[model samples]
Target: MTDEQQAVCEEVLAGPRSRLPAPLRAWLFRPELARRGQSLGAYARYGTCLAPHLSELAILVTARFWGSEYEWHAHKTEALKAGVPPAAIDAIEADAVPDLEDQQSRCVHDLVRELYASRTLSEESYRRGEAILGRDGMIDLVAIAGYYSFVAMTLNVFDIGVPEGAERPFGRGKARAEAL
Candidate 1:
């Protein structure tokens, strides 16, 4: 790493994240982008107005959309810790709409899925998002999805894997039927 790259690393490590994530490590190849991406990442992951469980749900949706194994493995536990139902996570992993009774969770799931499937939100989707999340929360929700999408793609293109011994979220996992 160049001196500039090392400095970027120091900046990221010194921030709230405290450690470099895999995407940031790859982005460090261009220190400038690393600097900016991490800044956005910090805000998306930490500064969002949405609750942690909602944030984690958005991330999981993004990971599933991209088939990002590393992202899924990393955030699945976080979603649970944030109080997301395991059944919802399992449904997401299985590429099915989760039977989320929570209006907010369902709103987030639909917003993200709409973003990916149509590349834009419909009037009704936007209305529901705004109604449930409000303007600021809606913004934060989109930002979370957008940022994690970038992270997921980075993990996929670089072939980043989950830690050894971690069950792969897709076919290699123990049994989806049980989780579902």
Candidate 2:
């Protein structure tokens, strides 16, 4: 690695995460992009107005939508750690409606689902999401989805998979909807 790239990698290693994430590691070919992308991911994942669980729920939905195996494998643990129910996560992975009992989680899921399905949100979804998340939180929620979708695309395009012994979310004939 070039000195610049090594510097960027060190910066990433120094972040809250103990190691470099796959997406940021991939971005290291262009060190500037790696630095900026990691910064954006940090804010989206940790600095968002939405609660950690809500942001993680959006990320899980984005990973499922993109069929990004590495993304799903990584964030599923984070989602669980952030308090999203395992049943809800499994339902999402299976392409079924998660039995989300919390209004914020339900709102986040509905907004992301409707947007992905129709490429836009209905007025009802908008209103409900806004009511639950507030204006700033709603914006952060969308940004979280958008950012993770970018991460998912990077993982998918580069053919990144989970590390050895880690489960493949959509691999090994775990059938779900084809990637959108």
Provide the overall lDDT of each model, using Cα atoms, as 2-decimal numbers: 0.88, 0.86
lDDT of 1 by residue, 7-37 (tens): 9889888888867887875798889998899
Supply the global lDDT for candidate 1.
0.88
Top lDDT prediction, candidate number: 1
TM-score of each: 0.91, 0.92
Clashing pairs in 1: none
Q: Supply candidate 2's per-residue lDDT for 168.
A: 85
TM-score of 1: 0.91
Error of 1 at 118 (Å): 0.8
